[model samples]
Target chain A: MAAAALREQLNALLSSMFASGLVDDQFQQLQMLQDDGGTPGFVAEVVTLFCDDADRIISELAALLEQPVVDFDKVDAYVHQLKGSSASVGAQKVKFTCMQFRQLCQDKNRDGCIMALAVVRNEFYDLRNKFQNMLQLEQQIQAQQ
Target chain B: MAGAASAAAERKVTIRVLLVEDEEIHRVLARALMKAVGGVELDEAGNGAEAVRRVREGGAYDLILADRQMPVMDGHEATRQIRALGVTTPIVGLSSDSLAADVDAFIKAGADDFTPKPLSKEKLNHILAKFNLA
Candidate 1:
C-alpha cells in the first residue's frame, strides 16, 4: 500500500479494533506517547515487550498448570502480570480474558483454569498478530516517506 | 499579576529529575513529559540498583521516577536504599500494580508517591506540582 493508504489502513484497523473491543484506551494512550516524537517506534517497542513477555509467560503457565497439584497462587501471580502487560499495551481482549483466568485460578478450579488458558492464548495471539501487522504497515509507510 | 510574574521570572528556577526504568520507552515518555512541561533536566538509570548508586553519589535531583519492578532490584528496595543513604529527594514509583497494598508497599519502602503504569503526563505533572517543581 502507498504511505497514505497504509496510514488509512492503520487508522481503520485501530478504530475497528476498538469498536470490536479487541483493544481499549490503554492502546490509545500508547499511540499518544508515540506521537510525542521523543521516541520513534515507541508503540512497536512496547508491542515487542508485550509479545516476548507473553510468549514466555504462556509457556511457563503451560508447565505450571501441568503439575498434578496446581498452585493457584503461582498461577494467579502469572495471570496478574500478564493482565498488567496486556493492559499496558491496550490488549483489551487479552486483559479481559486474563481477568477471567485469574478468577478461575482463585477458585482453584483446575479444569476452569485450563479452559481459561486456551481463551487467553487465543486472545494474545490474535492481538499480537494484529499489532505486528500494524507495525509492519507503519514501517512500510516510514520507508516510503 | 505583574509583580508575581516578575518575581517568578527573577528566580529562573530549573527542575532536575531522575528517571529510573528498565524500559527505554518509559524513559522516553518521562523525558518528553519533562520537556513539554519545560525547564526540567532529566537523568536516567537502567534499574533500581543503578538508581540507588546514582543517588548515593549525590546530585540535586528534585524528583526521581522509579519503576516498581526491575531486574537488578525492585523499586521498593531501591527506595529504601536511597533513603538509607540519606538522600531526601522525592521518589515516586511507577508500577502496573496500583492495588492499595502495592501502593502501601512502595510508601513503606520510602517512595513519596505511587503512580500506575504506563505513566502519563498528567500524573507526572501532578507529582511535579505537588513538589513545587512545576
Candidate 2:
C-alpha cells in the first residue's frame, strides 16, 4: 500500500502547481503517460528536454538583443518557439511570458525584451525547482514502496 | 509500519480511477496522488474521445476524474458520449475554473461530481467519498 504521507506530499505539490498557474492540462498528459507504464522518469525526461530547449532559446534571444541592430524577426522566432513548447508542456506562466515577449519583440523595444527576459528566467527557475522537487518526492515514494 | 500495514490490508479496496486530462503534468500528479491514496488503479485518456474509448473497451470504472477542456473532444462531450454508451462510471469534472455554470454544464453533460484544479487532498477525498470510493 502507498503511504498516506507520500500521497499528501504529492497532493500538496499538485495543489501549488495549480494555484501558481505553473501547470495546466499538459501536466495531466504526463500523468496519463505514467499510467501507461511510462515511468516518472519519462516525465523527468520530457521536462528536462523542455528546460534545455528553453535555456538554448533564451541564450539565442539574448544574443539577438545584444546586436547593434536587433533583428526583431529573429528574436520573434525564438519567442515563438519558446511559446509553443511552453504551451505544449502546459507551462502557462512561461507561455504567457513568452507571448508578452513576442509582443515586445514586434514593437522593437529592447528594454521590453530585457525586462521580459528577467521574467522568463525567473519563471524558468521556479518551474525547474518545482519539477525537481516533485521528482524527488516521487523518488522518495518509490523508495518507501 | 506493521500496524499500518495491517490496518491498510483490512480496509484494502482497489479504486478504479478514470483519469480525464489533456496535460502531462496534471496527469503525473494525479497518478501520484491516486497511488499514494492506495487501492487505486488508474485508466487514462488524453481527451474525451480517448477516455470514452478506454471506458468502452475496458469496461466500467469506479470513478472518472476528467478535465473541463481538451482537444479533439472536451470533457463535456466525453461525459455525454460515455453516458450515451450506457456506461455509468461516476465522473467528477476537474477544472481550474470550476464555475457554478461550468459545474452545472458538466453535470448536465453527465458528470457526477466536480473538483477544481490544483487538486487538494480534501477536495479529491470528498469527491471520492461522495461516490463511495474513498
Candidate 3:
C-alpha cells in the first residue's frame, strides 16, 4: 500500500476504535508520547506486554475457576490485575469486563465469574486483533517511507 | 522549580526521578513522560522494597513515583518506610485504582500526591509543578 493510503487507513481504524469505546484516552496519550519520544515501536512494545499480561491473568483465572472449590480472593486478585493491565493499555471493554468480573468474584458467584471470563477473553482477543492490524499498517507505512 | 535543598536558582541540571513499578510497560510510559518534561534523569525499581533500599542507600532523586500494587511490599509501605528514615523527598503514588480510600491511604502513608497509572505528560507535569520538581 502507498504511504498515504496506509496512513489514511490507520486513521480510520483508530477513529473507529475510539468511536466504539474500544480504547480510551490512555492509548492516545501513549501515541502522543511515542511521537515525542522518537522511539521505534514504542506503542507496539506496550501492546505486546499488555497482551502477554492479559494472557497470563486470563489463564490463571480459568485455572482457579476450574477448581472444585473456587477461591474468591484469588479470583478477585487476578481480576484486579487484569483490570489494571487493561486500564494501562486503554482496553476499555476489557477493563470494564474485568471490573464486572471482580464484582462477581466478590459475590462468590462461580457461574457469573465464568461468564465474565468468557466475555473479557473475547474482548482481549478482539483488541489484540485490532492492535495487530494497526501495527501491520504502521509497518507498511514505514516501509513505504 | 528547584529542589529546596539546591542553592542555585537555575535549573537543577537534571530532575532526578525514581520510578517504582512492577509493570515494565508502565516504566516505559514513565520514561516517555519524563522525556517530555526534558532534562530528567530516571532510575527504576521493580518493587517497593527495592525503592526503599535505593532511597536508604542515598539515591538523591528529586521525586519518587510509586506504584500502589506489586508482588512484595507495596507503595504505601515503601512510602511509610522512606518517611520513617526522615527522607523529605516528594513521593507520588501511582495506581490504576483511583478509589478515594486508596488515595487517602497512600497520603497517610506519606505520599505527597497520587497519579493514576499510564501516566500522561500533562499529569506528570502537574505533579512536577506541584512539588516544585519541574
- Candidate 1 residues lying further than 4 Å off, grouped into runs, are A69-74, A106-109, B1-14, B23-40
Question: If both were scored by TM-score, which would come out higher, candidate 2 or candidate 3?
Answer: 3
Q: Against the true structure, whose lDDT is highest?
A: 3
- DockQ-wise, the better of 1 and 3 is 3
Candidate 1 chain A lowest-lDDT run of ten: A30-39
Better of 1 and 2 by lDDT: 1
**Candidate 3 per-residue lDDT over residues A61-97, each given as its tens digit:** 9999999999999999788888887887789999999
* Candidates sorted on lDDT, descending: 3, 1, 2
Docking class of 3: acceptable
Worst 10 residues of 3 chain A by lDDT: A31-40
Q: Which candidate tops DockQ?
A: 3
RMSD of 2: 10.1
**Alpha-carbon runs more than 4 Å astray in model 3:** B1-12
**Fraction of real interface contacts that model 1 preserves:** 0.12
TM-score of chain B of each: 0.88, 0.89, 0.89
* lDDT (Cα, tens digit) per residue for candidate 3, span B11-117: 55778999999888788777766766677889999999999999999999999999988879999999999999999999999887788998999999999999876
lDDT of 3: 0.87
**What does each candidate score in C-alpha RMSD?**
4.6, 10.1, 3.7
- After superposition, candidate 2 runs with Cα above 4 Å error: A1-122, A125-145, B1-10
Question: How accurate locally is residue B104 in candidate 2, as Cα lDDT from 0 to 100?
Answer: 94
